[model samples]
Target: MKTLLSTIFSLLILAVPFFAQGQQTLLLVGGGQRPQEALKEWVKANPAKEPKVLIITWASANKKQAYETSIQADLREIGVRQFLFSQDITNSFEKNEFVNNLSQATHIFFSGGSQTLIMNILNSDPQLMNQLQHAYWKNNIPVAGTSAGTAVQAELMITGDTKNLEYGLGFLPKTVIDQHFFKRGREDRLRSFMKQAPGNFTGIGVDEDGSILFKRDPKTKEFNSTVLGSKNIMVIGPEINQFRQEKILRPTLLCSQLF
Candidate 1:
């Protein structure tokens, strides 16, 4: 019985890599002035000839229009022609329509605001969350987010106060994501959170104006992270309790090459 259990455990460990196959690209931007180069990378990730970008502004309330306008201008500059805003898709009557629209989107972006608001809405409806997972995992559509939007990408998300942790959208598994790293002086906060966190998860603290692009290698079936933008990105592994800062001098660099 002991030998059989060991064999089963080994098989499950080997199957992990296969389960992570076919995941699409994820672009996580640290809140602040979004680098134009990051936007270009996002636009380039879309494989569609006529890419339809969907902007989810559930995190923003008063700044929804402003955020949409700014993102639209940036996306337009990068040759994006079609755009869909989720401002009106709030009620039950529009849920099906929103899901349909998400299916057609070549790229999905979440605007910065409050991660709590985004999760609250998503958690209330399982169908919406499933559709988003389908779009990102099965459909291979690129998903991008900034600030609070970026926080939701992780399974463990640091709250606004930097004191408590909450369950996020789980787009990025077994990871704790924090934004505004240096500017907000959040290194200590992240370290504390990581210590209290349940599982052995890596903590990623993205500085303002910095971005991390997570793309899966088709052959290896493993996600390779690339640092983009002008500032530094802090990565704390489960084993390494100390902070490791990686400065991005160039436009793009693989995290594998760095650490």
Candidate 2:
């Protein structure tokens, strides 16, 4: 796993020159409610320089205008003005339109709901998926997601119900995120993922009000994570060699209040 992480880190450094901008940022929020500190940081990042924002609600079951309106009002309170809303993508035109629209967005956020729904929609349209990749990878737009929205950002996504882990949008290729961590006892599923993951992937378990902030260094190609909100962030990685009693710990998960 360490070797895999090293290889990926090296690759990211090499690929830095290909991107139009410098650094990429991601904010992953745990399910339920957003913490005040996380919300404050998100709002502060919303400068006039990057005014355009896209909010995706496809994961949300309540795809009504009222729900969107409520979200808009909350964002507006934080000084956000320009906005684009996406509830569903059915036709080719909408899909194409979404791809084109991403070019103008400075920030993109996915709302909370079912991760499966978001994956199904994104996978159904290859163009949309490609466009999103370009927007974040090359364009340097910051992407944020909550709940199921956070889950889909990993390459290996938890199905929520099943013990299996399937493909996700994978914005954070090296990490897998789970929401409502301690409250719902989802650590076991994450352990299952670590056991079955194809490559070196870090498992991040977030409490209902917790969030994980990720930033990539353009020069060194290193990634740093900071834990925010109340509660704690759980990190699970490859088993380490411990020569205490010759007892090999099968699963090694660490819990910390901060990253």
Best prediction by lDDT: 1
Question: What value of lDDT does candidate 2 attain over all alpha carbons?
Answer: 0.67
What tens-digit string does per-residue lDDT give for candidate 1 at 149-205?
A: 899998888877557788887777667888988899988888888876754566788
lDDT of 2 by residue, 92-205 (tens): 777766776676777888888788988888888777777788787777778888888899888788876677888887777756678888889877767767777744456778
Q: What is the lDDT of candidate 1?
A: 0.74
**What are the RMSD figures for all models against the true structure?**
9.5, 7.6
Error of 2 at 58 (Å): 1.7
TM-score of each: 0.84, 0.79
- Give residue 216's error in model 1 in angstroms: 1.5
Clash-forming residue pairs, model 2 = none
- The 0-to-1 C-alpha lDDT of every candidate, in the order given, reads 0.74, 0.67
Off by over 4 Å in 1: 1-21, 240-259
Structure candidate 1, residue pairs in collision: none
